[model samples]
Structure formats: C-alpha cells, structure tokens
Target: MGSLHPAEKPKAIDLSHHLNNLSRSRHPSPLKDILKYMVQPGMISLAGGLPHPSLFPFESLHTRAYAPDSNLAPGETKHGVVDIHIPQTSASTSNIAIALQYGPGTGCSPNLVSFLREFTARVMQPAYADYEILIHSGNTDGWNKIVNLLCEFGDYILVEAHTYPSAQALWAPMGCKGAPIAMDGDGLLVEDLRRVLANWETDHPGVRRPKLLYVVPVGQNPTGSTMTFERKQAVYALCVEYDIIICEDDPYYFLQLPAYAPPASRKQESQQDEQALLASLVPSFLNLDYQGRVIRLETFSKTLGPGNRLGYFVCNPIFAERLLRATEVTTQTPSGWSQAILAELLSAWGQSGYLTWLRNLRDSYAIRRDWMCDLLAERFDLENSPVPTEGVLAFAKGHGSRADRKQLFSFVQPKAGMFLWLKLNLIGNPEYERLRAAAGPNVEAQWNEAFWMQMIEAKVLLTPGSYYTPWEGRDPSPNRRKEEGVTYFRLTFAFESHEEMRLGIDRMARTFELSWNLVA
Candidate 1:
C-alpha cells in the first residue's frame, strides 16, 4: 500500500459524540482550580481538603541505588542507579511536602509530567498540532479510562484476533462487546478490518458498528507480533475509512528486540552492526497519526518496573482533557511517591542517559529471548526458518508432507517483547480430531481444557489462546469455537531465569511429544 498523504488521511472522529453519559456529564473539579495556585511562590492553600504537610511524622525518605555496579554482569558497563532521598521541607522541589500532600489529579508530579512531555516530543514526534498528555497509573488504568471515556453500553470494540486479555476483561464488564479483526504475522490484518467494517450491518445484524480499535502495536501481548510500517499505514487508512478511534496501548515499545540471529551466526556479527540494528525500530502509531484520532498509552512497567504504576497517555487535547477529568473522579492521581522518585531519576539520567538505559534493557531482554528460543529449538522438533504463509502456523500447516507430522510444533520467534507465541500441532493429536468430529457445544472448550491439563501435569504453565479470543456474543455460527480450536500458548521469557527457561521448555517439549505420540 502507498503511504497516506496529509490530505489523504481520514477525517478525525468527533470524540464528544462518542463519550458515555457519565463522561459527558463530567465537569472539572472546583478544587483543582484552587490547587493549581498551591504551587505559586507565596500562596497559602487551604483548598481541596488537603492534608497538612507538617502533620506527617517522617523527616526524610531514602532508598538504595537501583541496580548498582555491584550487580553488573561481567564485561557489562554499569547503568547508574537511582539512590534517592526526599527531605520533608516544602522549599525544595525534591521534597516529601508536595508528594505527601494532595496534588493534581493527573497522577504525575509536575516535573515528571514535564520530563515525559519532552520525552514524547523528542521520541514520538507526533504530527498532530493539538496533541496533549495526561499521566495515568499504567496502561491497565489507561485502557479502563479510555473505555469509560469513549464507549457507551453495548458499543463494539474492534481488536486484533489475539489481544491483551486484561483489556478485554475490563471492557467486557462495562457491557461493551469485542469484534475480533483477523491478524497476519504482522498483527491486525487491514484487509479483514476493511471487510468487517464494510459488512458490519449484514454480518452482525442489529449489532452496533465498532467505533474504537484497541491494539498493542509493538510486541503485541500474547502474539508478540510487531506491526510493520507498511502494515501500520494500511491499518491507519482503514481506521480512517471506517471512522474508528484507535487506542494504542504499547507498554513494550522500548523493549523491542533486534532481528533474531541463529546462535552460531550471532557470534559472527560485529557489535557495531548489532547496535545499528537496535536503532532501527518501527515507528509508533502516534508518529504516523495525522488526524487526531489516535490515543497512545505508554508505560514504564516493562522498562522501569510494574511496581511504579507510572504511565501516561498522548492524544489530542479534546480526549486528553476528558481523561484528566476521569482521573479526577477515579484514581485521583497515581501515587505521589512514585512520581517524585521517577522525576528525580529521570532528571539525573537526562535524555541520552535514559536512552542508554533503554538500550541496556533491550539488550538484556534480547539475551533472554535468544536463550529461550534456542532452548525451544533444541527441545522441540520444529522448523527454524520462516515459512511463507498467511496467518499463524501458515508454514507448518500449509507445506508439510504426510511424513512431516513428526514436526509437532512451530513458533514465530519474536522480534520484539518477551513472549514467544507457540502454535501447537494439535491437528496431529488423535483426541483433537475426535473432538472435532463430534462437534458438540462444549467440545472445543473440552479439547482446550484437556490440552491445558496435560501441560499443567508436565509442570509448565502457559496462557491459553482462548483467553485472548474476542468474545462476540452476537455470532450465531459455530465458527468462533472452531477458530478457538487452533491451539496456541503464550510463553514469556521475562521473569524466568536462564535455567528455568530451559526447564520450562523441556517440560513443554515433553508434554507435546507425549500428547502427539512423537517420542523417539
């Protein structure tokens, strides 16, 4: 597909018309008007029922350096740690006074907010002129806020066929329905999106057309598929054509891994070449969004740590201001202590230093990815090379000979993020075929349950593909169940140690071998 020109970009959706009743009724907090002055040089604020900073007992706060030189691996340079101390004084910017006291509902400390704005401007270079930023707790909170802000009850949310389960769980409870868009190896398939939107009324008779699209464009949660630049352009074009709002929840944007290299070949590549590869990452949706329709959710969860609960949203001022209003009534703000600590850390690191830290983080995860991939390759009978096929498991299912039944498993070695999405060869399982033949109402669930049980018995656990399946209650056919039958398991190499990763794969391979009766 050709690149979309400024004139060619779709018209922006009117966000005001899409907002729910509660969101539409929401007005700015009166206390926020007064709280804005609390930071002024001589302002004595008795507004907002804020707690007195003097009443707090603690005089200071301290913490050890996070990841000091002592913790560095051999030959690795030390990324400076964040040793912090916040005095009780109100005079100092890095003090506990403002942090301990009630502040703006926007979750982030003023300094942290400034830092993130600069960071976003420098890195993302969003094309929209009216874009604004709002701090939130994390992507999870961000997703919920967006759902509440945009979706009315019974509204359809378009998502990649394989998507973040937690996001679905949040939307499902709100009476929102998921409309699953088909995906290729690159993530959400544009053609499927076009087809679904074009035929919405006929295919989904009486159901509302989806106005919102939720996607994890970088290292998509369970699938670990990164949308290519061309694919993203096509997707954006479709979203414009369909008049859909895009919610880009990308927590793993910076954790993108370098292109995979075989174990033997990696040793041959020079360090310069590897660094060059790392620098060439795919552009974010925010970068490509010309119309102010894309709202991006970014987080420090994957990079800094989830415990911080710090993230922010980037969107046009219209949506951002509304999201801030949502925050005022809900979380009120993210933990002040987290924002304060992160502010100090970011100020110390600066932009270049921060980029270095991200590089170190990406390199570390890449090592883990390589370790896990190598173990899976050794333990499972698999195809190492990418096969030319459409959708997941195209290579194995399409080209395999009758004798190739012994090749029982395949995976798209992730180019980014922590997950390796394993497509199990359930077609070779005698029980699976039997269950398919019977085709009872609960047969698909039973097959998945049995398969899950076997894996648990083997002492390895993985997220079932069904958890990521979009629930379309309106569909009358049995095709959804059949689609769920294409067995997939998401494995993460993030938390596990090198040895533990090896052990997990060993157990997974043993379970597959036993189930398929392919033991040598």
Candidate 2:
C-alpha cells in the first residue's frame, strides 16, 4: 500500500435544506388523542374509528405463500427466523428477504400493484391495467406528494363542500386555496363546478385556474355518499373541459354497505329478494378516467388496519413521475414491511375471492350502520335531525337553513364514515333562530359553547366542524376554526364496538336532550 493509504472516512455533510424543523407529515395523531382520553376499560366505545384487527387475514397469510418457506408447519423455524419457516424451498425465503430490503422510490413491492391493476381493470376499466401506479405511505402521503408536485402558495384547488378535514388543513398552510364544489345524493355536482370555475375565471382572470380537483369517490368521508357512474362521467367531462387534474381520494372505496349481490343474477341466476342483497357500489374516478388525469388513492385503513398506513395511487406517468420524485424527496418510500405484508394478504385472497371478502366487509359495516341508525331513531327522534341519506353520515338541516342560522345548530343525522357532522348555530348565520325559540339573540353562542362543553365534560372527544372548511377566515387560536363560526362537529362510529356504540349514542342523546330542555 503506497503511503499506507487507507479508506477515507466520509466528510461531514452541510445541513442546509434539511435544517428546517417543518414536517410534511401530520403529527399529533388525532386518533391517538381520542383513544387516550376516551378509552375506559369497560367503556363501550363507539369512539373507535379504526378497523377491527379480528377481521385481518393473519391466518390466511401465514398458511399461504405469504410467508417464507420456513414456517409452513408448527414449531419449525428455518435459519432461526422467528416467523418464517423454509421447508418447501429456501429459494422462496430469499425472495421474501429481498422484499424486506429497501425498495425503489416508488416502492419495492410490485406484487400489490399487479393485483390492484388487475382488480381495477376487471371491475373499473378494462384498459386501466396499462396505466402507471405508485405505492404511498397512505392517502395523505399521496396527497402531500401531489400538492408538492403541482400546487404553490395561494393556488386554487377544488374540493367537495363537505370533505376530509386533514386534506383541508394540508392545503391551507401551503398558501393554496380550497374552493368547494357542492355535492348532493349523486356526488360532486359537475354543473355546479362548471359554474363556479367559470365565475371564478371571469372574476379573477389574473389568477390561475384550479390546478387539481380532490374528491373521495367511494363511501365518501363525512358524507358517505358514493358517486354514480353517470355523475362520475359528467365530472370527468367537466375536468376535461376545464383542463384540471383530478385527485381521487378513496380510502373507503371497498367499505361499502354489506348488501351488494354479485353480478351472477345478470346471467339468469335465481332471483334473490332485495332484502337478501344489500351491497352498495359505484365506479371510482380512476376507473372512469380515459385521459389519465385521475390520480386514484386506495387505502387499507378502512377495510384492513389503519395503523398499517399503507396505500397506493395510480395515475398517468406525467403526474406519477412527479409524485414519485416528491415521494423520494419526502418519505423516500412507503413502509417495505407493510407493502410485503399486504401483498401476501391480497395474494391469498385471490382476485375473485378478494371481492367476496370485501362483500363480507360490506355486510359487517351495513349491520353496524343499521344498528347505529336504530339507536339514533330511539334517542334523538331523528325526524328532528337530518335524515340518513348515504353511507355513514346523516344530514338534517334543522331550523338553520330556512330561518335563523343559529337555530340550525341542531343535531346532525347519522351519516357515513363512522362520523356525524353536526351543524351548530353560530352568530354568523343571519338565520339565527335561537332568539325566537328562547330568550334573546345571545342564546346562539351560549348554546354552542354549552353543547361542546358538555361533550368535553362527558369525556367524549370529536373533531369540530370548522376543521373541514378550506381557507375560511378565522381568529387566532390553537384551533383557528373554533374562533371562526364553523359550527360543525364530527362524531365517529367506526371504531367503537356495538355495545359501546349504543352507549355513545345514549350519551349523545342525553346530552342533546338536556340541551333541548335548556332551549325550551
């Protein structure tokens, strides 16, 4: 060795761009906070919003090729690996080990993508399997990447009138604006969106048009309304006209009401009663996209486990490439372990069988929905609340819309997504009805404070309604929306068990009843 040359140590790298303490990912796990305060040993928790682990395919995965060759039989651990056994073929073990390694920027696992592509094609579009796909940490991760790739501060983005809260928050801080498109039973109103965009363009010609449109197509969050095929087409047509991109956020696509009967009846099977078949569905935006403008996000949180935080997005290469670059720069890659585990579960389910499994999940949720609705009926006299329309949400515009907005601060109908989006009466509402119903005008704010305070005093936690609105004016506070007149509160039913769900409803019912007495 000339000059006793040795391997040089790596020089210290300068911390320039990485020095900031900002986070792309959402911290202060909201779900964790709810669980910590609300969970009691014997408390029947309708508060639970996560999937039931009992339903996961742990055994199915272990029995099939999901595992390595080693642990096929009991009490056998090949190579001292705790979980995997290698009796059938050690070569399989090597493949599994490779999956464990850090994958590409998009993802290491293509198995899940392959299955998902096939699934989307057979069910959504026949030609979609040709489109590009990318794995993400979850829907939020995919959303963040898309925002980074396309949006700049004060950029206009179209969202639903009632949409996911986290998405609303993420967009606002980035200096982007969220414009809401009205939604009805069908889904996002294309005609309304067309009018809004046209008006905005005319009013603010100097500003750029909305860069992207965000939506939750299947079992929509907060609203629980799924888009029909015709509506989806109309929306897509509008997007094409406006030349805007579509971000399809569909975490609950597979979590339909458990009442859908397979298409066997189309081939002339025995006629089943309507009561016998109650599965619900409609096509997804990604499935309907012919122009490759849709980036569809799929998540396992609703159907599988939320903690897994595993999801994938499929879009055209133009956006996909940018998104993957963002992923590389941000998260680098989704959890390799989660990708492999899900791939195994998906493989075991097989293609057709997976649909059947999803059907069963629908049934379970349908039962829960029915149970919850019955509870509400018995308690609140929902005739007063908004009627249950779609999947998980119930929207009843009490006294608010017609008269005083404050009077509108009535109870919300049990809607979809394990949440009840409550509409409260605030001073902003010109239609404040609390005055006529009771003493004077001050009753509106008093009632609002009283309701939330009681819920907190009762040890129940819920997300406030204002959290969902985009770029609305607000006062200074830790939760800025509180100071604003966003009188919306979301209560979930997904995580809580049946008994706990009942109890939660009972508690809510009691709270409402007490408030009602005060107003009377």
Candidate 3:
C-alpha cells in the first residue's frame, strides 16, 4: 500500500466528549466546591478533611535541617549531620536538593523507619520489635495493598457498622465483601465481632475465615471514637482466637485529647513526669501485638498534611514482601517528593520529639474538637447526643427518612478528621427505586452508586452504605445478603475553618428544614 500524504492523513479524532463518562469513576476533586462556587464566595469550609497549614512547622523546616547525612561518613561529620531528635527550623541549602530527587519505591531515601523503629521499641517493645515494616504512599494505599494481599476476589472482610468510607470503597471494586460487625460509641463491639465470627463459622464450616479484620482502633474516622484499653484487649483476644489478621488503620492515633499531650518545655521538668507522659497516652494495637498478626498503618496525612500522601505499615516480614510485590503492580509506590519530604521531617523529629509533636497535634485537635461538638450540640436536635467528645470527628442522628436525606444532606458540621457519618431513619416502604432516585445513575447498577448520586445531586457528596457489605460475586452468602436497610451518609469537617463549618451546618439545617417541610 502507498504511504498516505500529510494532507491525506485522517484528521485526528477527538474523544473528549466520550471520555467524560470516565470522570464518574474518578475521586471527588478537593477543589470541586471551589470550581462550583467560583463566582459566589463562601465562608470557611468544613467540607474538606484537611490539616491546617498554619499548624505545620514550616518555619522550623525552612531554618534548621541538616546536610545530607546519607553522604557523610558515620564518624567524620560532627558539624553537618543533624541528629533526628534536635528540632531544626531550616536545613543546609544542599538538603533542599536532596529532597527534589526521585525517592525509592519503598519510601524516603534515608528511611524514617529508624525513628519508627526506636519509637516502636520504646512504646511497642518486645511484641512489635521483631515485626517487619514497609513504608507506602499513604494509609489508603497501604490498606488497599493489605486487602489485595489477604483477599482473593469475593473474599470477605470485617468492618464496623459505621466505618471509614474510602476503605470501604477500596474493597468494593475487587468483589470483596465487608461484613460490618455492630459498633458502640467506643468503636467495634467486641462481643458483636465474636458473635458474628462464630455465626459465620457455624454457617460455613470448612471455608476460609475472613481475609482480615479491619478497624481504626484509635480515634476512628467519622465517629471520632477512640477504643478503650479494655476494648482493645478484648478485640485483640478475639483476633488471636479467630486466627484472623487485624489491619489496624489508625490515622488518628495521635490526635487524642489535650490531657494526653506530653510535658511542656520547661527547665525543671522531672524524669518521672516524662515517664508519666508516655504511660498516659492512648496505646495502639501494634503496641499490644503479641504476634505479628496486627498490621499497623501510619499516615502523615493528618498530622503532617493530607497533600503529602505519605503512610507506612509495620508487620511481619512475609507480609511486607507481599505488600511490596503488590505495590509494584498496583500504585508502583507513593509520590517520590512526598515520600522524601516525610522521611526528612521524621528523620529530623526522631522518637521523643516526634511523640512530643504528636502530643501537640492532639492538643491542637482537641480545641477544634470541643468547638465543633459544642456547635452541633447547641444547634442540631440529634437523636442521641455525644458524650464529651475527644477526637477530630463526631457522629449524630437526625430525624428524617431516606427521602429527607436527599434534601437535608449537607447540614452536618464535623469537628475532626475530614468528615461526619450520619445515620438517618428509613421510612415506610423499602424499595431500591427510592434509594435509586436518592442515589444517582448507578442506582440500578450498583446499590451504593444510587445513594452516592442522590447525595451528589443535592450538592453534597457522600459514600453509600452498601459499599460496606460482605456480599460476594454472583453468589453472595445468605448471611451477607444485600438488603435496603441503609439510612446513612458521611460528611467531612477537617477541610473547613470554624466559620466555614458553622456555615456548612447552617446551610445543612436549612436543607433539612426544606426537606422536612416537603415531607410533611
């Protein structure tokens, strides 16, 4: 065949319009609201789950960072290599160059695990000492990898009744199921977990147990519920008894109440007080892991900044190898720049200083926590009021039906993390169409999609409740059979300022009033 001439070459076909459909599957843009309301300005937005940049030690990092200690001979440099513990406001100019380079797939070039190791030792001790560690892009990445490693298509995983939405979303596409065990305000109900597991076993004898048990054992997302030490012990015992792996996804482990903050910098502070500081802090599941079964996921998204997209997991060497293999195939690793910056920050912070920083973060979040809770309590007539709140998020129940949720969706003002989880009352008939209309396009295709659509169309976005089900491929087990009982939505508060949070709440209240007025 003769070669075609330049003029004869077919004009390049454009598929921009056709490609628009793909955007539906993509993540909600952080800047979506900004784009939507570009012309009309608004107040501080609690709509995003974001960390305050003002709180970050930007000045400190700009001033005191050390030179590339990786290049220095161990004993040769007393002048350039800054010890990880001593806080620095800036680094040598060369340190900036080091951060700009591409990082290894595993994480920071110098490795933050050293500090993590020391911190793990001082706090976690003998149990976690022997466990292996692997760094990743973020907690979500780590969580996906853990599920990928442990679960085959259609396998089941366990979660709390109301839990983190992103994690639930991650499992949905893989044909995996989430069997939501009931939860109390404190977190996953241990007795419920025990009963559910026993029931599953009784029902399906020889088949595999759940691929993993996922829980945010500390300062849980949405609910901002922290697991008590007693609860932790009970849950841990169940995992041990069940021979199931526990994926401990605690991004809010450090954002506890102000009472947990370490001692202030003062000349006369005693050693005894330091010991007390360490003892009083809430313990993590990894801290109590007698076996390597507990996989601890750590993230810089909360304390550092969500934009950083940095997180790590500590567990058995075997699991680490599997996670790394999965990382190679899936995400290929987190952002190189993010990994480097995080490593540099952690390497400079060391164990004690890092703990001190975490305590400070907890104290900062506590103020926001109280402010948000007080606002909600004064305004919303929730079915069940909260106990004195501690963490960054809170859960509330409003009097409304699934239809009311569509109109009144946006009223929640969260105090912590990036969102709030709302459980609404479903009225009258239970049919998929009503949920489908409330949900959007996917209403008929995937049950969750409908719920998502309903909320999205209302100018508020939320993850659907169905994504948490443990129903598997073509054959969803009878125990995990899908039903139309969901009456909930998640809203984020971390992104907005106090003013924005209040505004979002006020707007939501109006939305509810309008919705209820129509229903009446």
Whole-model lDDT values for every prediction: 0.75, 0.58, 0.56
User: How far is 328's C-alpha from truth in model 3 (Å)?
Assistant: 5.4
Clashing pairs in 1: 107-334
Q: List residue ranges in candidate 1 displaced over 4 A.
A: 1-14, 44-47, 66-82, 90-92, 268-279, 384-386, 389-404, 437-439, 474-481
Order of models, best lDDT first = 1, 2, 3
Candidate 1 residue lDDT tens string, 1-520: 0134334435434566667787888999887777777768988766568777788887888875554222223246665557777788745456788777777877537788888888876677676655777888988989999998989887888988888888888877777778888776678888888888998898778978888999998888898888998888888888878778899888888888787776878863333333453357687887778788899999999878899998999997778888988888788888888888888778767776676667667777888888887786566444544553222232222234445654455578787888878666566577877887887766657777888899898889998877887866655224342554466778998888888888888887677666666565
Alpha-carbon lDDT of model 2: 0.58
Instruction: Write the residue-wise lDDT of candidate 3 on 93-166 in tens digits.
Output: 22323333233345434456666666665655425334666778788888877766676665678887666668
Q: Cα RMSD (Å) between model 3 and the true structure? A: 18.7
Runs of candidate 2 exceeding 4 Å displacement: 1-96, 126-129, 258-280, 384-416, 424-449, 472-486, 518-520
Best by lDDT: 1
For every candidate, C-alpha RMSD to the true structure in Å: 4.1, 15.9, 18.7
Candidate of highest TM-score: 1
